[model samples]
Target: MRFTLFISAILLLGCTPKDTIAIERQLILSADFSHYDNFFPIQTLNLIKKGIKDKIHIMYVCFDPGIDGEKEFPGEDYMDDFSFKIMKDGKYQPTFDKSALVIGNDFKEYFKEDFDSYKKLKAEGNISRFIEMPEKPEWWQYDQTPKNSKGKPMTFICQIDMGRIIINDDCRLFVFYDQDDRMVKYVYQRT
Candidate 1:
C-alpha cells in the first residue's frame, strides 16, 4: 500500500497544473541539500559516486544549450558540469539559477559560509529572499565568461547565476540552476 502511494505521488507531481506554484515550492523547500552535502562533499564525492549510484533526480522536457564534459581543476577532476532542461506545458514557468554550487573539499568553506548564511536567513524568517551559495569562489567566476580554471571557454548552458562556492584554500566549485527548475546544474570540486 505504501509503495503504491509513493508511486502515485511521483506521478501526480508531474501532472500538477502548469500555473500552480505549489508543486515547485514544495519541491524546492523539501530539498535538504545539507543531507546530500554531508556525505558527498568534494573530498568524498568520489566515494559517494562509487558507492551510491544516485542521490537525486529531476524531470525536464528539454534543457537549453550548456557546457558539457568534465572541466578539470589542476590537481583533480572533482568539478563536473551537468546542465540540462525540462519542458513542461505551463503558462507560468520558473527558472532555477543554481549554477553556483561547489562540491567536495574545495567547497567545504563555501558551503560553510552558505550554511552560516542559511542559518541567519532561517532565524530572521527571510529565507524566502534568496538561495545561498558556497563562499569565496568568486575568483573562479572572474576567469572568463563561460570558462573554467583551464581558461577554456565553456559552451555548456550553465553558469553561476549568484554566489560562489569555495571549499578549501585550493578547491572551488560553482552552481547553476534555472528558475523553472528545468536545469538543476551543480558543479562541485572533487578532491
Candidate 2:
C-alpha cells in the first residue's frame, strides 16, 4: 500500500500543474518589506525615491520570518502605512503609488517624467539595461547550509535585495531579493 502511494506521488510530481506552467510576464521588483516598523532604517527606500529617471514596473515580494499572518502593505486605505516614506524638506508628502509598499520614490518619478524615453529606447532596439544594485545589505549564502527533503546538508546560495533598516524601534524598512547573489551578505535577515 505504501509503495502504491509513493508511485502515485511520483506520477503527480511528473505532471505539470496548470497554475505552475503559466508565466507571469510582468517586470516587477520583488522585495520583502514587512520587517521594518518605522522610518529610520528606510533611508535606502527614501533615497531610491529621490533617484530613478523613468517609470519602471516593480514587483515586491516580502517574507516575514517571525510573524505568520498576512502581511500589511500600503494602499488606498490609510495611505501612510509603509516601511518607507516620502519626505520633502523633512516633511512627508504623497507622490507615487503606495499600493505595493515599494520603496524608491525616484523610480516612480522616472516613469512619469520620461514616458517616451523608455519607449524610444525600446523602439531603437537597445533595451537590455541591467538595474544597478546600490550599496546596501543583502542576504548571505555562505553562512547557511542547504538541506534536502530528508534534512541532510546541501549547497546554499542567497540573494538579498534589502533588509531591516531601523532608525528606532518605531521606524524601519525591510527589503528582500528575487535572485541569488552568492557573495557578500550583510544586514540580511536571517531566516
Candidate 3:
C-alpha cells in the first residue's frame, strides 16, 4: 500500500529523469571542493542554494581558468584572481559557524555574520543596505530554453548573473544531480 502511494506521488509531481534526483542528504555541509587552501576564508563563500524543502546549503566557488581538471589553489602568495581556491586542510571546518553565513541566518552579531557583505553595506561611513541571499538556482528559468539532442539542461556559454560573494560577475553556480553519489553537487562554472 505504501509503495503504491509513493509511486503515485512521483507521477503527480511530474517526476522525470531530470526532475527527481534520489540522493540521501545529510544534516552537515559535506561538500567536495576541487581546490585546497588552509586559510581560504570560507566564511566569505557564497551560499547559493537555500533549501526550501531539504534545508540544504550549497557553497559556490571558482578556480583558475588556466588550470585543467578539478580546481586547486596555489600557495598563500598567489594574488588570488578568480577566488576558486580551497582551505589548507586546517582552515575548513565541517561544523556550522553562525558568523560565517552571508544571509539566511538573520542579521546578528554585526560584521561577523556578514563578513563578506560588510564593506558593501557601508557607504562612505553611512549604512546603505545589506546584500541578502541572491535567490534560488535558475533551473526553472533555464527549463524554458530548449534542451540539446541528448536531453541535457542547456548550458549557457558564459556566466550572466553575478552572485553575492563566491560567484563573480561572469560566474554561475549550477546544481549537478550526482546519481551515483546519491547527493546533489553544486557546480561553479564560468559560462
For lDDT, the strongest prediction is 1
The parts of candidate 1 lying over 4 Å away from their true place are 1-34, 38-107, 130-191
> For residues 1-191, could you state the per-residue lDDT of candidate 2 as single tens digits?
74555345324323211211111112111123223221111111112232321222211222222322233432321222222221222222222233333434445443333333433443554232211232332333323333333545422111223221111112111232111221111112233
Using alpha carbons, what is the TM-score of model 3?
0.29
Better of 1 and 3 by lDDT: 1
* Segments of candidate 3 deviating more than 4 angstroms: 1-55, 70-162, 166-169, 176-181, 189-191
Error of 3 at 4 (Å): 39
Global lDDT of each model?
0.30, 0.25, 0.28
Tell me the RMSD of model 3 versus the true structure: 14.7
Candidate 1 C-alpha lDDT tens digits along 1-191: 74565345334322212212212223332233222332222110111222322122221111112322133222222234334332342122222322223345544565566555434544554222222222223435344223343544432221222232222223233443333343334453322
Better of 1 and 2 by TM-score: 1
Encode model 3's per-residue lDDT on 1-191: one tens digit a residue. Answer: 74565455434333322332222112122344222221112112121221222312233332322333222322211112122211232222222222222222232232233334423433233221111122234542343232333555432211112244422234444433211222333334343
Residue pairs with clashing backbones, model 3: 37-86, 37-87, 37-88, 38-87, 38-88, 62-84
Model 3 poorest 10 in a row by lDDT: 38-47
